[model samples]
Target chain A: MEYRKIKDEDEDGAGAGADIEGLRGKAFSSSAVSNMPPVERSKWKRKTIVTLALTVLTSSQAVLIVWSKRAGKYEYSVTTANFLVETLKCALSLAALARIWKNEGVTDDNRLSTTLDEVSVYPIPAALYLVKNLLQYYIFAYVDAPGYQILKNLNIISTGVLYRIILKKKLSEVQWAAFILLCAGCTTAQLNSRSDHVLQTPFQGWMMAIVMALLSGFAGVYTEAIIKKRPSRNINVQNFWLYVFGMAFNAVAIIIQDFDAVMNKGFFHGYSLITVLMILNHALSGIAVSMVMKYADNIVKVYSTSVAMLLTAVASVFLFGFHLSLAFFLGATVVSVSVYLHSVGKLQR
Target chain B: MEYRKIKDEDEDGAGAGADIEGLRGKAFSSSAVSNMPPVERSKWKRKTIVTLALTVLTSSQAVLIVWSKRAGKYEYSVTTANFLVETLKCALSLAALARIWKNEGVTDDNRLSTTLDEVSVYPIPAALYLVKNLLQYYIFAYVDAPGYQILKNLNIISTGVLYRIILKKKLSEVQWAAFILLCAGCTTAQLNSRSDHVLQTPFQGWMMAIVMALLSGFAGVYTEAIIKKRPSRNINVQNFWLYVFGMAFNAVAIIIQDFDAVMNKGFFHGYSLITVLMILNHALSGIAVSMVMKYADNIVKVYSTSVAMLLTAVASVFLFGFHLSLAFFLGATVVSVSVYLHSVGKLQR
Candidate 1:
């Protein structure tokens, strides 16, 4: 991570062909990266595969949870799902492997000192993101869907303001306007009546979504921090470490809360369909996190996330025979605009 | 834009800071750029302003349509919104003016032959995007929110494959894995629910979403083409020109088909807010396009778009009161991961 700052600035700064090449070569040549004993590489690879397996496993558990809830099996599904969830425990072992592997990369102990100094010291933001995701799920457990959606709008403002403060990023005029419009879109969606009932009584869900937004903001801030600390590190490495830590934390909590349930559930759920899907989903998440960490800025990562949601919003209406009022569409569009503007604002700044 | 190929490849390589500066200065001082008369500068500025206005005006009109549909005060809100959207247009114009007003230093503009001729030209991909957006909105008008949300996952696949074929950009293992996982996530979402209620006549909505996805893909390709053609233009200029062309096209379409519907509906439906928001979105889009085009690559823009969608998805769940089953949460997470990977993949390529 530690390197001399090459101060030359072109209009199209960095990421030119040469820069990308230089980075790759530097990583490959460093004794820190190169002297990885085969044992470490194998261990690292194994952990990545296990994490991928957990992702796929989760998909089936999700299906079971939904189907079981419909069949008056909430408690049963929770218990059953917990068993399926145990597959994620493998992620912990993977985490151990990663820590060991990363340690192995430290051949030049002196270099570690320099790298440490070069990297952002703040782990608070990353911690906040982990907390945020956990709370988001917690709220999801309690709150109805529409309510969760609306509260999410707060991120439009929260992240915008946070990026400004933490990343020292500036906002453009259009970005501010976009942010306001996004909020307005949320207001309009609130008025649409479709999501009204779902959001009403579950105050806890509402709180969680709010917390998630804030956490997401913090995650965003920390993501930038990590990227800035080691501009040349493979983003996959950054992402893997984050997941390794976050998943391990989550697995620990699950085990502590329901040790018996974790031990009892089947390794693979009924029909095998749901289990397969869960594993795939987990794998996807792993891949996406790694990629985002590698190439784009955190804000850009956020922007892509927004667009994907918009696409899903549009699709949900037709695929599920669910009602999508003009209000929903309008709100979604506004949110899209806001997200788009946020990115533009970054550029303008 | 073209310049003589660097005959001395060694000096032209990295570390040739002085060469870059000389080129920058030389390019700025070229008669092709600086020799323009005052009349030409004013003319170019006017055209740029007009182009900016056109994009803002058209996009505002589109947003106003959604707002009016929601507000039921179409005639009033449309106009107010239009006015609101125009504010951004004005800001962009002002920015351009400020840049020119502040242009006191040596400016070079040597007319150099461009090397775009060396690359293969493909217009089919570009034309495809135009048709895609129209189809997306058309589907949107009919589909339920949730249905549309699920189907949009196709975009990651679409963009990646297209890039592979058209740009010959290699995909990484993480990217391939992410795409597979994203597709799996979509499949899981579709499976988790009962399939009893397919849209008997889904042609209108489903087709539209499909088309929109296609168009978005095309737009992605078209932008890449522009970038490939002029590898050296400033990102701002490239983005500005893209918007200029896109806005011009959109504006003309509006003028020809539903100028009365757009303007009259906007005015009667609260024209000020709708107009202002639309203009703002357009201006932001323009600036974003320019920045991505100049500083980053088109894929960077793609990554941003994806991140924005991710944010929207998570936010929409609560905002719209959509049911957030385990599957939805997991799927969204997967989507987020896919976005990050895609961004990083592009960077690697």
Candidate 2:
């Protein structure tokens, strides 16, 4: 996902008469975007479809995780086993990509030079992701699925600020307003007046959510820099090193917190059909994000993720019978509108 | 008060490097502004100072009104008396402006016009304002002072929308985003989780606030059109007709709503030092608005009025012991920032 293509859409996309739906012709069809190769239309379509898939996978993961649990608690060492599954999934993706490159006779330095020097750069973001993923699970203890979905949008603010600081990306005034609106929306959503306990996200949940957003934002910007620093490197090769470090970090996490529990209960103690599906959803969503980035831009990813939030909320309402408060609904509406406005700003840039 | 001077300030005032503090020549001083006469520096300074004074006067009115009342109720009809006071104030202002014209030895048709044709246009806005002002008095029956002050910001949205509809003034995407944020902020402010009854605006209050905002927006935009349609017309001459019609409408309101009550208890039943001061504040604020408009722009008025909202809230806390909820504070903060963003958009335009 870090190795993404970025192309300027029509200014009309900024509501400046931008053909937001098509956004072709003189607007962005010209091959003038810095650092971006001319995009093939089919590739763009494929990436968009993949992003749509990512949306479904991401939205379903939380609901599925909740469904997999019994009495609102997970039977497994939720912390220990997910990393092992993710490790296997990453290895599989790398194997597939390697085979494809070999068939194409791509034995260049970028492909073969996956030395320790290059692999060494992956650990920091991997470590950040490790903490972030762990928090994702822990956060469930404090908030319901719908509430968690709303809180997840707080990541956008941290990501936007970090993107500006680390990448020196200039966001327009509209873009800044959009970011503020998104933050305010997420805050407003949290302020939902739910007298019931089932849908409320507590103060502890908010703290954990903020930490998670920060860690993820740092990891994301850092990873993006690494990917863009040497765009010639095969994305699969980079993912290989990143996954290796991620697995190593997750293994360390398992050792520190869930080691004894996993040892006694066995690695597959709480494994069930739904748990397997959730793990699959998680792994596939990760792959889908990378696939989308191979063609589409960050704005697409942002839009899809925001849509996923509303999808998760609606799903949670139906599947878990969660209550959607008026404030949450209005706040989410604002968040969605702000996301659109932010994308418009993205096109302007 | 409707008559005023108009000039473009520095684009920096829009927060766009617009010398928000001293936007001067080579910026707005180049005298290229369409329909605007070149301004003297001293005149601009005087107008801005008057604007500041207007802010102070506007903020104090609500506080003074609450102080003037006994047990949160007014002995006289609030609806009937304000218009009478406003009429007298407008008349005084018109008289002063007439003297200024006489001193300048100016008696052009633009300065002397008081025809039925000219005066007729004034009644429409006066009527709209009459209805709006009546609602202002009735709304207190539904909401408290602090909440009402927050809700008053709903006017921004209506004003923005109507400005576009009536004036065909193009708002940039950022300005549109800012407007949305302003609305979101106002709504969020209303959602404050104040346990006490004194700081909350109920559902009916929301409805009334919206209506007030719409009425004021229409009246404002329409009045601006009338004022700008003939740039050379002396503003004082125009204001005289507006005042005359406003007084007429205010009298009609008295007849329809409080004929028996006023006839029996007399118009001065609720008279107090504070009441007189409140009327003075209201009248002076109106004059100050026109005075500021002569040299400044709508953005300056907006900034002053929003600041006045905060001033009102703070003052309410000390004088009436109003509770300032966390949500209200956060919401007002967002609204303030959005106002700045919107002003920046204005500068861009």
Candidate 3:
């Protein structure tokens, strides 16, 4: 990620001499608002928009997913539903790529990346994510929902470790501190009210959660790195490849776990309005994850999910009669601080 | 505080010109280990020592105070003990100032200030401290200890605000985030297990806590500003004046709260080894606070006291069989991160 940033600075140095003449021409007309050039301001504004959009979309997706799961158990097979979500996400990415290609002309990496090596890389994360998602369902049998919510925060820590190891990114000491606080805050936010909680997590459940977190973190950081490897590549192209592989992996899972059920009742067995919404939510969230990985990083994705967790907890207070605990309040406060420290601290000179 | 640092840099520039000859002489002898000058390394080492010492001392004082009151009441009169602690602290400061004077000779600020204006400034914080300390006793009557513990964290936020307002210090957005996280973490760490919590804080208690927090914050920041106001002032001399005023104010409080008790019995009525030890601890902690405020700022004092809160809680778990809750663990993690970010993140650039 920083490598690409450095390249931009190099390009800026080369471009500044040529742009000087145009800058002088515009100075007369735009002198009143001259602190930052309009182009730079617009770029910053666009980045902010993207980050905010992703945060809102991801947070709403969390609420929707919980609402859909309000029925104690899913009426549909998890395997088939996951496959459909992947398929829809794949289609969305292709549609996006098609629009961009038409407007900007074809690019080498954006149009499915013609290189064999690049094509092979997408399957790695797809397989990891597939295993992680599958494990998510099995782990629920061993650990209760609240316990799992707390365990899920392990991903924040894992993501930071993998980002450092795989991306060779050197986070400042302060950023690492921010990352730890984010993880702790998210975990604290997930704490169930005393009366609602049970301390019955099995040893196996702990092991499974660790595995799931590692898989999720690795897949996320790997996806981010590959998309950013070719910074000029269209994000839709990367998302398309990722979802295509994701569909293939989920298809394999379905064949193993739900083949007979799907064959007997069709793919939309136990379908409902809520189920369709769930599929749509998952698909859009998948697309948002890819866009965030491409434009932002694993850190931003972690921050969004953490804030999302807090928002979900807040929604639960009103919608599901969840008690608003002091733990949750303090946790939310810490998370807010972590977000501010991360975005501004690292950037402050 | 920053003004003093700027002056030091200016001195370094002039000294460096004269020191170049000495640097060349040392270059030959210290060429093997020359990344940093030994003098610079020693200065950094001394700073680390001071910070660590203050942290340990403050944390120990918290634990000891709690332990001394394990029987649930102070047998000794609060007013007289506070007065005695203040007297001891003043004597300690005077002794320190005398030692410095004997060694390096008396400087204007290193001894009692000849300026009446400077002597007059000390009583403001002393009076504020007096009210805050006296309120500490009254607050317990309204709020449970745990609830009061949570409310006490408001001082961290208030101190940050006053530090900025009084010192004209512009904290980066990240530092503000760190302060918030520190406040939240301390509050979380103080969360009593559900079985132990009363959740019965009255409106009056809440109001009193807020007022106490503001008073404590203002007194601390005001003291820091004055101590750092004359950057060359001997810390011991400044501490001496503050403590003398503090002793005088506590004497007034003693006259009101303990005059009858003292007249009937003695000034040391109901005293024990624990009470005497507690007074000594309070005195040393007071002196340490002033040293920290002068060398550091209200922020450092807040951090020290916060970490001290966590340490005291951890000690309670082992010593008093306090049940260790997940809330405490998560809170400690957040506090640790806030410390790291406040120390390293803002300094990273």
Candidate 4:
């Protein structure tokens, strides 16, 4: 039964590229309406600029972070960069929200019937992710960093299993083999690390990190599954808006707490600037994501963006003049290759 | 055009359950054999027992780890349980390799196609997954534990964006809202932490964790996309065989490594034991995944299994006597709720 599925899929794979391209052309036809109202056309034009600006800005920042890390500047620089990037992320997310807000209730050109309803609407996946993050933060406060990192890698393995089980997707020999390699690489990196001995107290941070990774996988897988069930919507834009919404929630929560301390904090002392930037960044990312979804496949988009994320991470290590270990480099390389291969596979077939 | 696709999909979605189920049943009946050779039948029975045993043991071990962590005994105890679980994982993986070796080319009882060569071959995704794992291990060695954990959660957000871009799937409003909820939870978790204001050095571990999570998403999305294109050959055991193949590679690698250190490394040390367990874990997981694919939808399976993973993770934290901050707890709760809601939605119309 399964064997036949694979054969059919392979046969289809050859022609799929063309099919997808055709789908894209048709998908965008509605959006490409001629003689649109000036207001709508202007909105579209502005959005186009916003999207271009974000892609360029993000791409540049990603590159700069990578370069700076290699240059090895001040000790605080990495942290600063992280903060800046995160702030930028927040802003991009907000921008995405703005785009969504502008076109709220606009139905998708292709909408599918879903099981979603007001009563059944729930936020478990997202909530679980947050819980996982909070747990990690608490754990980090108590544990060693490297220990946590090792555990974090388990997410891939876990997700690989989950993907097969949940998605009912058949993995090729290469896909299966690659995941093993990834696990092997992670183990190797850990074994080579200095702290192989028992910990006085297990690093809470490390535990949290692992939990976070797992939660992330869960959320991601669920999102993918659910998204597939719906009609093709403005995914990129929606993602950004979601971020914006999340940020707004965070900001509001912060406001109810030690607002003064945060306002007078060292890095983001100016609320107005950070707030505005955060919104803009989030919104822009949404648009960019939407554009990517509109044009490419999920694997391709993810793989490409992950490369950017990976570079950003590597830059953090060197740019901040942080101490580097051999195992760390090995692990990073392993991860980079895995992401690249996965993305490439998606693109090819 | 987009609208029509949505309509088509909706029509398909509503009737697909029956269509697919009916198709599967028909395929099964056509391929169903009345006179199985005694040799093959016996072999299958044995294989099923072995698979079941391995799954039960590993799952129990996983559960045990959670329970021990919740009980807050010596950290070593939990580690030991985890180690056993890891060994089981290794053994399971190896066992899978054995299965593939023994069963390769013997397509029987329900393959979509009888020949593996009929499918398009691709190794890029597998290689990419391998790289992802290596990177994860590298980062894990350097970062604090909790920090690593939180970073991993970023998988959810990344997966959402990637799915939209790569799969051209649409996300519903609720799922989109859930994404926002997750981000908020993570941000709150970050803010709620009482860690030092200034970093002494860059958190390499945390970065690595995030990198691993991102890689997993990339690999996972690609795997799903590819598998969707290639239907499974029916034997309901392709995933099993794939794992078997993957395990073969892993076992060879493990055996080639110097066993002296691993075998004599104090408690739970034994290269042979580790090797065995790893094979078993991988093998069962692979086959089990195929079973899931055969019986259920992708998102539903993922969503359900994720619940189990999260519950186990949370259980581990409490069992281990890890500290739980209020805000962190709240965030985690929200994330869990969001995921739950999403999963529940899948079960609906």
> Candidate 2's error at B151, in angstroms?
7.6
The CAPRI quality class of candidate 4 comes to incorrect
Q: Is the docking of candidate 2 incorrect, acceptable, medium or high quality?
A: incorrect
Error of 1 at B238 (Å): 2.8
Candidate 3 per-residue C-alpha lDDT over A157-221 given as tens digits, one digit per residue, 9 for 90 to 100: 88899999999987766667778888888777666555124345678888898888888789888
Runs with alpha carbons beyond 4 Å of true place in candidate 4: A1-349, B1-62, B66-126, B183-211, B230-232, B252-268, B271-306, B313-324, B340-349
Instruction: Report the C-alpha lDDT of model 3 over B1-349, residue by residue, as the tens digit.
Output: 1111101110100000111112222444354235667886554444444555656665565555666667544666777877787788888888887788889898776767658987889899878866776676788778765566567677788888988998888776656777788788767766655512434577888789889888878887888888888888888888788878777887898787679998998988777777777677667666666666655566666776676667667777788787667777888887776665564444443
Model 3: share of true interface contacts reproduced? 0.69
> Which residue pairs in model 2 clash with each other?
A12-A17, A12-A18, A13-A18, B3-B235, B5-B294, B11-B18, B12-B17, B12-B18, B12-B19, B13-B18
Scored by CA lDDT, what does every candidate get? 0.43, 0.60, 0.66, 0.40
Q: Supply the DockQ value of model 1.
A: 0.03
TM-score quality measure for candidate 2: 0.75
- In terms of DockQ, which candidate is strongest? 3
lDDT tens per residue, model 4, B1-349: 1111101110101111111222222344324322457775554444334333323433433454334334433222112322343344445544554565467744443333335553333233444544554464466456544444445445656666766777677665444544544443443333223222113326665466556655655654554554455454443334433333334433333333324444556444433433334334433444443343334333322333333333444555666655444333434544453453343223232
How would you order the candidates by DockQ, starting with the best? 3, 2, 1, 4
The deviation in Å at residue B282 for candidate 3 is: 1.4
Q: After superposition, which runs of candidate 1 have C-alpha atoms over 4 Å from their true positions?
A: A1-349, B1-130, B133-149, B182-211, B262-269, B313-325, B339-349
lDDT digits (tens) for residues A1-349 of candidate 2:
1100010010001001111222332244444323344465544455546766767776776566557553343566655555755586578667877786768766653364566777778798777776666566677778765566456556777777877888797788767776676666655655644422422467888789888877877776677676666666776766666667767777887787678988998877866676567566666666665554444434445555655655677788898898665455546756765766665666665
lDDT of 2 by residue, B1-349 (tens): 0000000010001101122223323344446333344465555556547666766766676466556553443555654555755586677766877688767766664465566776667778778877776676688789765566456556767877887898687778667876676666655665644323433457787789888888877876777667666667777766666667767777887787678988998877765666566566666666665555444544455555655666677888888888765456556756765666665555655
Assess every candidate by TM-score: 0.37, 0.75, 0.77, 0.35
**RMSD in Å for all candidates:** 18.4, 8.5, 10.2, 20.9
Worst 10 residues of 3 chain B by lDDT: B9-18
